[model samples]
Target: MDRAGERSPWPWSTVRRVLATGGVMIAIAGKLLAHDPSATITWNREVSRIVYERCASCHHPGGTSFSLMTYQDAQPRAAAIKASVLSRRMPPWGAVKGFGDFRDDKSLTQEQISLVTAWVEGGAPRGNNPNALPPAPKFGEPRREEIPTSGLAVSGDLTIDRPITVDGLWPEHVPPGASMQIVAAWQNGRVEPLLWLYEYNDSYRHPFRFRRAIEIPAGTTIRGVPRDAKIVLMTADDNSWFSRLRALFRKTG
Candidate 1:
């Protein structure tokens, strides 16, 4: 309304325009807050360690992929890294977490993924102190002699013929981008989860070592594996002296 107004020019259309403008300003303010530089998440403080420990194995100098060893190297690719982790595509562990515990699990925890998201959303700040950064990860040439040549491959459901101590599983022949869930169903009706392959890629295939050895008794049926998908049961010799000693202790005690 103007001071000399006979009839006010204010109308529903003008009101809507003003409201929309206000909304835009509010949205901009929210974005500013979300991208606040002072936010706790920073490359040096949190993300560096995570990347060094988890991603640097492949994303290091002279490694298979591009290096993210320094803040400068990682900052520009922050959004890409965030997207990869959010999609569960980086750290390339393949197995779904919590289904089976593994010693060499490389998948990020939900909290860790959230930290990365917040860091990226907060403008990927490098912390104040450069000295606070963890040491860059080191890599060694993969020893050819250490790689396993063979393992017991099970294609479909298989019943254990004898008690065997299993250390891990290897996805031997799962088609790229295919998924499979393997489980060991005991005769007494206890089902133990073995491994879950989600959108698996053979390029990153490796043995999924269990956190602890699983002693599967005879008659325990390995099930849920697809007919075309072959999973290798990584096992220790049941006749080994260590295994015999453990079995003797189990029987005596």
Candidate 2:
């Protein structure tokens, strides 16, 4: 008789079943590691703020595009939103990052973009707290009066004829789709980056207001503008005779 303590070895079929189960478990673990668990990110907490501040300008109801002003409106489009932000296609600001500092910039930061991606990948959950949502942004009609009347429009390369303080640049005439990089080369060989337009769409034209006014002395050459494209230098000296004359021409001619 066989010893009582001795037991029969496991069958080959049993070992194969165990191996298959382990493989499935490993695959599931790999998938989890591939994406953010998105355990903390939620529509009410973080995403709503980002969308309102950066996107609501054009995406709110009765605005330029479809409404992303509410969680219900945004949840369904989470995937598309993620793609747009990742590709830098939304917010519609054409200026490249790190080239110049501008106020009222609508472009999302890398961290903000990642948060959006994770929120989408994690199933776009609306958090438990509805109160976490920020206040809605106020929309207003475009102020045509605020647009500067006194400025110099330059089509090609231009050398500064006199010392002037530049406040900002407005892309006065950008082709439907064009890429241009404009720079200011100083007399001392310092090249300051002004603006870079990539695949610019003229329909959404707006002035790029600098963080602070830049004082450009005489002899600085504004270069890199395409002969076909025109950008206006919005200067601080609105009382200059040249500016007054140009404004007069714009009104009359």
lDDT of 1 by residue, 113-190 (tens): 988998999899999988878887667994332333444567677777668788888776887888888998888999
Cα lDDT of all candidates, in order? 0.81, 0.81
Superposed Cα deviation of residue 2, candidate 1 (Å): 66
Instruction: For each candidate, give its TM-score against the true structure.
Output: 0.75, 0.76
Q: Write the per-residue lDDT of candidate 2 for residues 1-253, one digit (tens) a residue.
A: 1378765487778888999999999999888865445456889888999998898888887787899998899999998999999988887887888987798778899889988998898899999988888889989884352666667777778777667777889987888879888888898999988899888886448888899888887777888888788788888665653644333222110
Instruction: Give the CA lDDT, 0 to 100, for residue 160 in model 1.
Output: 70
Model 1 poorest ten-residue lDDT run:
244-253
Give the residue spans of candidate 1 off by over 4 A.
1-38, 143-147, 238-253
